[model samples]
Target: MSPLGRPVSLGGGVANRGQVFRLGAAVRRPVTPHSPATHALLRHLSRAGFDGAPRLLSADDRMEMLSWIPGVAARNPLPGWSLSDASLVSVAVLVRRFHDAVRGFDGGPHHWPRPVPPAYSDGLVGHNDLHPGNIVFDGERAVGLIDFDLAGPSGVVWDLATVARCWCPLVADADLPDGFVQGPERRYDRLVMLLDAYGLNRAGRVAVAESLVDNHDWTYRIVTDAASAGHPGFREYWAGVAARTSRARQWAVDHQAELIKAVRR
Candidate 1:
């Protein structure tokens, strides 16, 4: 089918939905500054039997097409399905399987949306954007990850940190939106649960705890860069998101010791 085919607008994604159009059972979006490496990454996922991500169909100068995954994409503050322990464990299992599968794929040198730190990237790619919105859940279980634009070379800890910060969320209450609700032990419980499911050791726990702090800043820096470059979406997201990230960074730093202690369990 042609790229200009009559298409339906895809919902759920907030930031990078520019020129996204879905046709029949496939979805397509402009490649733009995002590298062709994204196609390679998705192809790798397919070959590795990693079914946690969308299957890449094709890519050209105009757009990339992927097998449209059918499921509900979650939003922040989370929903009933995303909040359950069973769903949490299922998501963790998905991430672990992804890491195991990707370790066997060779990414070579390619342009990624974000760079992975040495401490976080050990020659393997991990989905760095495993947040509520990017995950597709069928009922109460995560079926697959939707956004691969930010997936690149990274270690398991980086992936685990992304999962924890979003699912568990270590940010301050002041940063949360009004009417948001979660249990008190949810943070520690979910984070430790993720750690346990990932089979992390003591050193790995320390590294992951530290990454919770770095990830806070790392996530915001990308936005700041986008805003500076005059990205409309980034500018709007920054107006409120920047402050939350700053506070979240501080929160992560303050709770690092506590997280380490808890993650070690």
Candidate 2:
């Protein structure tokens, strides 16, 4: 059991929801920018009328209290619930809302715990990792986003690419699960729809698509490096299916032009 009221499970730092635990009335970890940023981000979301994140309670000795989001996280390849139109739309809308909410807050001058590779020049900060597991779903709809560990000042386009990479998933058709492979064009179409829903301009779309190509290798390297430095969560993740996707990154590079055209169209 964690300082929170329930047993703690490791979150993917992006899409997978944090393990469920009961709320504890104490702060379990030392207060730092990392923890406070979660609080600030959550407060911003709440103030902006988005209710899909954990509610930050005052610090406790054992843990920071946050409201548990009850739903399944849409992990990689996206289980059935997240493949639908409704879930994609909801994800786009919610992330847009979250970005809007955080637009005004200062990230303060604190040093971030992790390396946040710069992408493009959009004013909004990037959530960085928008993998399927970070998104919580109720049936066929996205209800919340979790694990703000990588949130930082970044280009909005970068954030979009991260989301698209996981959701629209620019991998080779063969790399996709059976359900997604059957409707390749539909997936592309959904990418377009999600972009439109986020209210991105043509320039933003182009930047995001390009970034997806340019950043794939760098991002993978960073994840691998982090894992080697004794970050247990990342080490475990990299040791899993992600390590096997070396070819996938090469594929992205090989087909950059085609992917850009698909997303742009």
Candidate 3:
């Protein structure tokens, strides 16, 4: 039940399997047990006045329609617009708003689309992935977020950390976009600014920094494993994109101490 006339593009992530189609202005995923939970969350977010996500339309025979959000998604190395301080701050704010919006929604009874690893901290749902491509930007500003296929109950701080890893990057200099590599200090400052904008407490800050290191390996393993399983999107993405993510991961690991000091300063 995607929008009525928009074209559908295939080949992205493994989780996106099962015939994703676009109708006029919506993208639809086939109906499954997880759909109820996803739909419920989407409905709650929409009702809570968070306009940075899709509007859920009723389910059809095999799909559900979600209102199309217009903007470009910053996939990798990110476009310059996504690297600006303004965009980073906007993203932090938007994610914080979304977390607040869904604070009361229940996921206990429904089956989630993906596994929820252990909670990164006590009160946050594991927002497992908040990478750039999942976020929509409008000229150095985050206008919306797409892809909730992995959202589940976990720590709020952990979720924030996930966002930082992508927006602030926290990756090695060589792995960053050329402009960012030239000014790692400024990029580090942006990460701090993003944290401040999100109003994270000291504990949240620590969790974010630590998660960048801890989750890097786990996240990569998950993607690579999924790719090996013959998931078309992931397989294609791994062949062309994931190999480079390892470099970024190594960059984060190598510079953890420096990044922690910078962010905490």
lDDT of each: 0.77, 0.68, 0.74
Winner on lDDT between 1 and 2 is 1
* Least well predicted 10-residue stretch by lDDT in candidate 1: 176-185
What's the best-to-worst order under lDDT?
A: 1, 3, 2
Task: Tell me the alpha-carbon RMSD of every candidate.
Answer: 2.4, 3.6, 2.7
Instruction: State residue 73's C-alpha deviation in candidate 3, in Å.
Output: 1.5
Ten-residue region with minimum lDDT total, candidate 3: 119-128
lDDT of 1 by residue, 1-265 (tens): 5554668887655466556777877888777566577778788888888888888788788778888888888777566557777788888887888888787777667777768776678888778888888888898788888788887788788888888888776777675534335655467877888778777788887788878877767777778888889988878878867677777788888878888888777
Better of 2 and 3 by lDDT: 3
By TM-score, highest first, what's the ranking?
1, 3, 2
| Candidate 1 global lDDT | 0.77
Off by over 4 Å in 2: 1-20, 23-33, 60-62, 119-121, 242-244
Regions more than 4 Å wrong, model 1 = 1-6, 175-182
Q: Show the lowest summed lDDT stretch of 10 residues, model 2.
A: 21-30
Q: Write the per-residue lDDT of candidate 2 for residues 1-265, one digit (tens) a residue.
A: 5444565554445222253344443212234457666677668777877787766766654455566677888887566657777778888998887787778766655344554454464455557777787788888878887766677667678777778777876666667765564476565677788898999988787777678755566567667887878777677778775744665666667766766686677
Give the Å error, residue 233, model 1: 0.8
